[model samples]
Target: MNAPTASHHLLPQVQARDVPKALLDALQARFGAQFSAAMAVREQHGRDESAFDIPPPAAVVFAQNTQDVSDAVKLAAQYLVPVIPFGVGSSLEGHLLAVQGGISLDVSRMDAVLSINAEDLTVTVQPGVTRKALNEAVKSSGLFFPIDPGADATIGGMSATRASGTNAVRYGTMRENVLALEVVTASGEVIRTGTRAKKSSAGYDLTRLLVGSEGTLGVMTEITVKLYPLPEAVMAATCSFPTLADAVNTTIQIIQMGVPIARCELLDENTIRMVNAHSKLSLPESSMLLFEFHGSPDGVKEQVAVVQEIAGEHGAAAFAWAETPEERTRLWTARHNAYFAGVQSRPGCKAITTDACVPISHLADALLDSVTEAQEAGLPYFMVGHVGDGNFHMGYLIDPTKPEERELAETLNHQLVERALKLGGTCTGEHGVGLHKQGFLVEETGNGAVEMMRTIKRALDPHNILNPGKIFSL
Candidate 1:
């Protein structure tokens, strides 16, 4: 039952390129107070939620507007210094790391919604606008944006990584919602891609190219995304199952049956216990599926009835309905906090998080076997999933002082990724191929495909001055 062992997915050895003093002088002179060479700022922007311990960027530039981003990138391009576009630093992958010496371009100050075109069901926003902020801004319009990656992530970062979350089962991911973008090229040229129109065949679809490029491509300055009408009625419920398989099977059945559930999430017993302790709530400490149904009142009722039948057939217990908005918020907030719960479950421990997504029919195959491997390994771990879409996250909590545990955890992750790939799935669903998953990306997509990716990177960022040493090595 033990996880099949594989070599650790080691991070690339990044050689720090020296940052010329002239570049620093130019940036400081140009940006004044907006540019920082402060060690604290550098350190803060150096790492993300990922475990890789790379040195921080040499400097940080807080961009307050699209002009600021363009100017800063232009300055960096002049010195041929690497520029890593940063959001709120919520990235789970080592996306923000200055693996090569560079400047961290902080765009959180650009948090402004430019315009809300309610009539057109579209909104134009600054790259620094967070998902929660955008939703709050548009809630009054009766049209809401549905792609949320659970961390209150910036629309810019989400677009860069093609992020999706719980509601992706129905609405879709950032790749679908992002309609257009204003991107600053490696040469410091500002270019627009796509338009407000929903569909277009006019050109190369450069918008899609940049959506999931993970900042290795260009710096996104402005974004326009589609909005959806708020559902007439929303129902949130939790169903505890006798076994993890029952919970997953129930989710698989729900999707296969075309239930159109807004969110169908799975949390194993271990994860539920951690979340309960962390969030101070009494959720049933068993394998559980949290469901949210959105539609007309009658339509929601129909969907709920159908899901309940599916759960019953899979041995799920009675549904615990969160009928009120407050109750539903509490439940989802707790679900969103699952990563923190897993980390805090053991004091001072860090979790090496990874996710694998497969075809709906192969979800059980990809998830169940991985769960068994994790159980047999005897590592302290927690599991959760956006099961309606066949994407599951497994976090292996490890002691930093124990290198052996870290190695074991990585091996487990490698095994899981391999399994998902064998099952016709991806190594990462939303987290993107940051420093950690570069090797898996090659394995999953092949050398030729990765070479094509490298070609694209070279063609766009000729100097490799933008988030270099990410996605793939030149």
Candidate 2:
């Protein structure tokens, strides 16, 4: 067996438990084909995109609906076994790892578009529905969900992580867009939070609480999200700058001027080089910014002019725009696949991703200092960010076979996160505190707030059977 990877940096002493036969027999009898103890299934459900190496779950339960999730939780609670909710497994913070032996409740099969109220600009969907699938389902209605987290991530996973992307600056992230959710609690009780009409002062704000809880408190079954009408005219563009500082300055000025650009992404020279090689494009090997403007023709043109003026002042060169939909898709697709491109740049290398956010005023200093530190440490890393919102990601490529390389990567991440916090930022901007940033959460929020979170977790899941040992341990 492999040594289980715990996100806390310290190797947790979690022994594999002897799963009770009664619970297994009951699950197999009641759920029939929906339950499986196969090693292959368990292993698949145990892993995520994070670099952590963890033990597989004892079994995998395919939940097809909210009731299935509730029942599975009921059984797990009865046996006092951890229940780890599995989505598409795209999480980078070790959210899906079954560190302690338990059952993986996969909700990918629960994909269903429950309803779409075009007039209300809202869509209700099952936890399994991916972002692209939801857009395709409602494309004809001229409405789309703007919370694109690069991956074709499931809606449930995005909500659970409170994911955001390039468009977050203009529209919003899962935290802002999710209006309601039907969640199954630790005790197998189904509860609804928020409402369709929006703006509710009803009791506790359970919806927001569970949105980024990382399935540690409850399993979200149904998610109601806000949607935006598709823009009449959309334009995509890319600009090259002489230096990273120039690119960062241009982004800062653009945001400061209140440009209503839909998407603004910053890619450092190394990331651009990797992307060009992976995407087979001749983009300049220089610090670059990718942007998209969404609005009427006049509105987009006005936004573009304001952005161009700012870029020009910062020594931007080779300004280009994608006029056709095909061209626009190709440009954004390359941006979306940046993580893969960075990984593929070094074969057999794993990416230790960093998610840090600061106030707009501190983004440049925080980003520049972090970049300087990584480069000085002699580690290979790629940079990309939704600079419009002061949230960015760094994918530090490391050869997993080399322990020294992992150590260096961790060192760089620690320094980067420390700088962000010092600048009044967060340890994680979008990626939830699954396992990776548990210690940093304490540093960022102080002991009192973290203790409050633990208190809430204990109150909700008294048995500690809901994804135990993640976010924070009791």
Best candidate, lDDT-wise? 1
Q: Show pairs that collide, candidate 2.
A: none
TM per candidate comes to: 0.98, 0.97
What are the per-residue Cα lDDT tens digits for candidate 1 across 1-474? 234333236766668888899989988998999999999989999989988788889999999987888888888888889999999999987889998889999999889999999999999999999999999999999989898678989999999999999999999998998999999999889999999998999979999999999999899999999999999999999999999988888888888888889999999999999999999999899999999999999999999999999899999888999989999999999999999999999999988999989999999999999889899999999998999899999999999999999988988898899989998999999999888788888779998999999999999999999999888888
**Candidate 2 per-residue C-alpha lDDT over 372-409 given as tens digits, one digit per residue, 9 for 90 to 100:** 87888788899999999999899899999999888778
Worst 10 residues of 1 by lDDT: 1-10
Model 1 TM-score is 0.98
Weakest ten-residue segment in model 2 by summed lDDT? 1-10
lDDT of each: 0.91, 0.90
Pairs that collide, model 1: none
